[model samples]
Target: MRKILVLSVSAGAGHVRAAQALVAAATGLHDVEVVHCDVLDFVPAAFRKLYAELYLDLVGRHPHLWAYLYDKADRAPREAWFSRMRRAVERLNTRALHEEVARQGADAIVCTHFLPAELLARRIAHGEAVPPVWVQVTDYDVHRLWVQPGMRGYLVAGDETAFRLRELLPDTPRIAVTGIPVLPPFAQRHDRAACAAELGIDPQRTTVLVMTGGAGIGSGAAMVERLLAIDGDFQIVALAGRNEALLAAYHRLAAAQPQRLWPLGFTTTVERVMACADIAVTKPGGLSISECLAVGLPMVLIAPIPGQEERNASHLLEQGAALLALDATALEYRIRRLLADPALRAGLRQRCLAIRRPAAARQALDQVLDADAAR
Candidate 1:
């Protein structure tokens, strides 16, 4: 069997989730032994903790600062002096990661996060005869950090991202536009009535699903409160993803509007929740938007963090798949407008379906395997 190493880092949940989607796609393939792991596992404990926490801290509490830093990093040349220094420090901290990659003895390596790809690129550049490395960018935008030399190929979420990659890497390694892969549940449509019945929500009333992403860009309670003012027969299903205080806040809101407020925290059944909702209000992370597209769920994107998410919002708005909700008032206005027009909602859903790539993980794997065969 051809062993394939699938590596990811838990900087945020999206990269790890994307890697899991790839693993799910490769599960039953008899010819391939797929090994999925975190590259950070090979690094020292302190280095791993600090590296992961720094990202969450910046994006969660200090968003504008995070945005500024993100823009600064992306604007610099891919292999600029400071970038080289940063990568050098990373390499020194993750010395064992290089050895782990070599020890895996895999035919090909796939990275959902950029760090492993950069580390492996160094080995390939040094003529170490490392396994070919394919990178799956988990976002709509390509930052300078992800543009590493000596990559065999890349899979991206959109055409513009591929174009950006071409501009950065003049060599133009084979770039595939395989949309961000989502979980299996998102690929199939659930019965709306059945899902609604299970959740004890009204099937006939318009339902809006709200997700405060892991980054916590927006306040769930505030969005729900703003939605309450809209003149419509609607129930809001607000999900506070892994945030305890927010979940508690939702419970308090639910007390007064028992039939109207559906509060959920850290659910695994997002597809089912989506099935019951007529419209989705969310932060447009790459994976989240991909999942919405897979299910033909129309979206109103809110509180997109400045750099990558703003890029994601622009793409979705231009595609006619989502609306941008800039503030509480805009969110209420958009939701009211979308709820009032069936034709408009249908149009958005159709656009989402048109752009959907539910089997992106499978498509990406096939392409990678084909490349390996040619070699």
Candidate 2:
């Protein structure tokens, strides 16, 4: 059996989601022993928890501030202070990561986030590594941190990103644009109308699905309240993710407006929800963006985190697959505008269909394994 170690962190749900999808895809093809490794956990537990808390605080409570920091990080010279930040983090936990990798006897390593990628890079550089390493760029944009000479291959989410990577490392033959890895359910799920019927939504009416990232970390309450105030004909289904407090808040809000809002707690059926909905309103996390593309669901992006999410949102906007709302007020206006204009919505949906990369997971795994075989 081939032992595959998929490393991810919980800073944001997108990384873990993408890693899980890769595990699902790779296991389907071979006698694969898939393991989820949280590289951040190699550090002290308190430090790991602090990073998680800091991410949520920055994204949910101080988005504009986070955006400003993100801009600075983005604008920083490649391989400068930003790279130093990563190197510092790697230094703190590199020994633990090296021990874990050696202990697992990983035949191959797939990194769904930059932390693990950077960890493996440092370890390999220091002669503390084993196995062939593949870095999956979960975002549409490439961060220099994900680039490492020791990596056997880089699985990019799209062709545009592949172009960008080529500009950075022109001589590398290990780059492949295999699309963004998404759960197998997205590739296998079918029948939007039937899916809608199952959800008790009117199949004929335009249905909008709103989700915060995987953890349901967006302003669902305000958006739902405004949408209900405007219209009730089109159904609104909001997934609140794992935030029990937010779920309870939505349930309380839905109690008075039962006919319009279908507020769901954490669920594994987002693929079905995306299939049934006419469009999705969400933060532009990489996994969510790829899932939308797979099902041809256009997006109204709101409040993406700085750093990687900003890049993901920009990519979608540039491709005409999504509309970005800078704030809650702008979000309301954009959603209303799209809902009112059938032609505009149709155009966005068409663009989404054109850019959809449904075979990403299978293609990425195939290329990674092929490279290992060649070696």
Candidate 3:
């Protein structure tokens, strides 16, 4: 069996989710062994903790600063001194990563996050016989950090992103517009009436699913309150992922309105809940949006973090699959409009169906396996 290593980081759930999706796809193929590696495990515990926490802090508390830094890095030249320094530090810190790769005897390296790709690219540049690297960009937009020259192929979310990659890395090879990889469950077709019955949701009422990714970082309670206040015959399914306090709060809110509200904590049944939903109100994280698209659920995107999330929101809006809710007022207005107008909701759902790539994970797996076959 050919061993394939998928590298990911936990700065956010999207990267790791993408990696897992690829693993699921690859596992179903013949003569392949897939390994999932959390790249942070190779580094010191302190560095790993800091890396994850720092991202949360910046995105949650200091988003504008994060946006500024993201833009500055994007504008910096690939070979600039800062870029070189950043790559050098990553290469040094990921010595264990290289060792792990050799020990696993990986035939190819697939990276969902950019850090591993950068480290591997540097090793390849220095004449190391590193395995071919395939980068699966987990966001709808590509940051400069993801642009490395030695990559075997680049997998992106859509044609617009492919166009952006061509403009940014004119000489890069084999950019595939594979859409973002989502889990098999999300990719499967689901019956609305059956799913609603399974979840104990009302089939006649419009169901709106609200989420804030796995971390439960967004305004779930506020959004739920706004949605409930609207005068409509709709039900709210609020998922507070891993946020116990938020879950408890939602439970309290559901107590008063049990018929119309359902509160959920961290759940493995997200795909099922999504299947029962008429629409989703969520942050514009790549994985969340991809899963929503897979279900052909129209979206009401909440305030995305100013960098990658902003880019993701823009892409979805441009595709006519989602409407943006910039604030509490906007969220209420958008929800009311969708609830009031079945034609508009149907239009958005059709657009989502048109753009959905349920087989993205399988397609990405083919890209990896085909590269090995060519060699």
Model 3: pairs clashing at backbone N, Cα or C within 3 Å:
none
In the predicted model 2, the residue pairs found to clash are none
Model 1 stretches astray by more than 4 angstroms: 213-218
Score candidate 3 by lDDT: 0.87
Please, what is the whole-model Cα lDDT of each candidate in the order they appear? 0.87, 0.80, 0.87
Per-residue CA lDDT of candidate 3, range 1-375, in tens?
Answer: 888899999998999999999889875567988899999999987778878899889988888899898999999998789888877667667789889988988898889999989888878888988898999999999998998878989999988888888888767688998889998999887788897887688988999898863222345776687678888789998888899988988888899887889888888878988888888988899999999999899999987988899999999999999999887787788988999999999999999999999889889888888878998
Candidate 1 lands at a TM-score of 0.95
Instruction: Encode model 1's per-residue lDDT on 1-375: one tens digit a residue.
Output: 887888999987888889889888887899987788897888898989888999878877898999988988988876688888888889889878778877889999999998999888888889988888999998888988888889999999989999999999967799999989887788887999999987889999989898873244346677787787677688998888788898999889899887999888888889999999889988888889999999999999988878888999999999999999877777888888998999999999999999999999988888789899999
**Candidate 2 lDDT tens digits, 1-375:** 777788988887888888888878875555667777877767787778777888788877787787777767655665687668757865775578768888999789888887777666766778864688888888999876566667878899888888888877645758899988888888876887888777877778788888863222335686677777876468788888887877887788789987677888777888887877887888888888999988888898877777778899999989999998877677778878888898998999899989988888778888877776787
Total clashing pairs for each candidate: 0, 0, 0
C-alpha-based local distance difference test score of model 1: 0.87
- The best candidate in terms of TM-score: 3
Residue-level error in angstroms, candidate 3, position 303:
0.7
